[model samples]
Target: MAHPATDDARLPRSGSALDVAEYFAPQRTSSEDLPEIEPLVKNLTIGVLEVLAGVREVDQLARWLGEDAYRALVTRSNLSARARSARGVAAVRPAHRILTQRLCEPTDGVVEAVVVVAGPARTRAVAMRFEGWDGRWRANSLALL
Candidate 1:
């Protein structure tokens, strides 16, 4: 009798084993293969600020963010909404200007940047890390200071 493993008809006949983990894993794209990242960074910075300010929904920016970053933004957005509720402050679109942006590339496909924004109330800095994945830029980490 044939062994159960060898008798399986579902296995590939090509003789080359398939690596399920690697096949399903997120693909990392090189910087050379990606589009200009500056525009994406700037847009994402503004989008994130809007989300946290409750002027925009986190889902609007979900496609540009990784799993962890998306979850964190959702949590932060919820907290902001709760705080607004507590203070009885209606959600208003924040009027702000992007003051400056500083970026650094520690790796070929990864960029770390900080954007300084000026608002009517105060100036704040948003730090973010973007990685090239599957031919697009995705925010993997973000922090507002």
Candidate 2:
């Protein structure tokens, strides 16, 4: 009998296993081999989710947060910092259906991302930016996103 494709095997082919490997392979951002964006994107996503669900306190964030994200959220929750920034809120939250465009590395150290926020007759690009900080690509700004 032949083996079935596992979950990760379903990724879009990069034309060959070598390309596929290079595409998904972990590269060192800060000496460790974690894919730079995954964890940070996840933390940012969770913070957004919690805020949308009316959990605004920074302490509500999980401690396992990738550090850069932890600090970003902390700054966001601080009255002095949050009040100074003119940021917009997403009209539809995650439970409503959120889509993420695959992140692309357009330059040497920066990653560009497009998160689509969807609602009835509405779709908006939540433009996100990330920088490699201590081995992870943490959200630089939701306001910019």
Q: In lDDT terms, which candidate is top?
A: 1
Going through the candidates in the order shown, the clash numbers are: 0, 1
TM, every model: 0.87, 0.45
Task: State the lDDT of candidate 1 residue by residue for 94-129, as single tens digits.
Answer: 888999999999999999999999988999999999
* 1-145 per-residue lDDT for model 2 (tens digits): 4355655665565488788777677553641333656556545555654554345555565333445555765665564334434454433333535666557777665676666655455555555666655455555545423
Which ranges in model 2 have alpha carbons more than 4 Å from their true place? 1-43, 59-94, 100-102, 119-122
TM-score of 2: 0.45
What are the per-model C-alpha RMSD values against the true structure? 3.1, 15.2
